[model samples]
Target: MSGRKAQAARNDELILQAARAVFTADPGAPIAAVAERAGVGISALYRRYPSKEALLQKLCGDGLKLYIEVTERALAEEGDPWEAFAGYLRGIVDADTNSLTIKLAGTFQPTEELGHYAMRASALATEIHRRTVEAGVLRPDLTTADIALLLEQIASIRVGDERRISELRHRHLALMMDALRLPPARRELPGPAVTDEELSSRWWTGS
Candidate 1:
């Protein structure tokens, strides 16, 4: 590649890295914040992303891609099924705490392109859920949809101002592992688990 082209590529990656950090802290952070973190002027970023939503959309896509890769690794890992399941939860919680894009995934309205991505990610998760359930480690009644809501709840916790969010999230994940273990039989849950219909209704429309 030409020197100028390579430099441009480097700048783009830097902007993306900055966007990930800035977005994680505040999804609504202005484009200028990303520019500041990237050490580039706002014009430089605008030349690449055009708009805040456009930039965030790209970041979200990248986040989902990373999530799939990590999740697949967790599933493929060599270990006891229960351990694997717990590890999957831990991995996702850890990723969620870092990737601001994944943290805000629930807010994304699945447009045509992103909807397919969501489905792909969901499918991989379902496979992981299948393996975990097949091991009889998870509560049989727990649906794949439940994982989204559960992790989201964990992601929202703020244990303390000074505490690490990943540490807090992982702590909750440990608690979740204990609760997720299958009983001798399906014990009655307090309420209905999240339904697929309900989940599909959550598409973000950029409102």
Candidate 2:
């Protein structure tokens, strides 16, 4: 990367760190305050982000990448297919409910870049589903689409309290997984389809 691009990346990182600190301290804090904390001019922040929603989207995407990394590692380490699936599910839920993640999920819009990231994540999720199904750990009827939908729903839940979010996610995930254990006879459910509108509405409430 060129010097300017590197500097821009550094600035973006600094701004993200500052935004997390300010938002964690006060979710309703002003963007100007974030810029102040980041030691950048408000104009500079705007030039980089264009809108608060854009900033939040970038932050959320970054958080999701981290989540994916952990999930991938767990899947590799855990020898049992079911255990790997469970680990991935829990990792995703934990990442989604993280304070920074939650704040971004509540505020960000689904941009093109975000959509690409989602697609990549969905592909990985599908692979996990396929592996589990082949191992007879997941119901043969359970499709990767279904798993993705369940994950999206879990990710969209917005409990402001971190502990409450974590507990609720765990409870829901357990219940959902139990339901996925189907009888041998009924083993072919269709995958759930996700629409752009549905995803955009879930995270971005803005008009």
Best by lDDT: 1
Error of 1 at 31 (Å): 1.6
Model 1, C-alpha of 68: deviation from truth (Å)? 0.9
Candidate 2: deviation at residue 86, Å? Answer: 0.2
- Tens digits of per-residue lDDT, candidate 1, 138-171, equal 8889998888878878877543332455555666
Overall lDDT per candidate, in order of appearance: 0.74, 0.70
lDDT of 2 by residue, 1-207 (tens): 999999888888889988877875676788888899999889989989887777777776787577668657765865877777778788877766355644454554587877787777667767787788888867887777677678777755544355655666676677677777532233332233334654466566477
* Window of ten residues with lowest summed lDDT in model 1: 185-194
Instruction: Judge candidate 1 against the unseen true structure and give its global Cα lDDT, from 0 to 1.
Output: 0.74
Residue 50 of model 1, lDDT score: 92
Models 1 onward score TM values of 0.74, 0.59
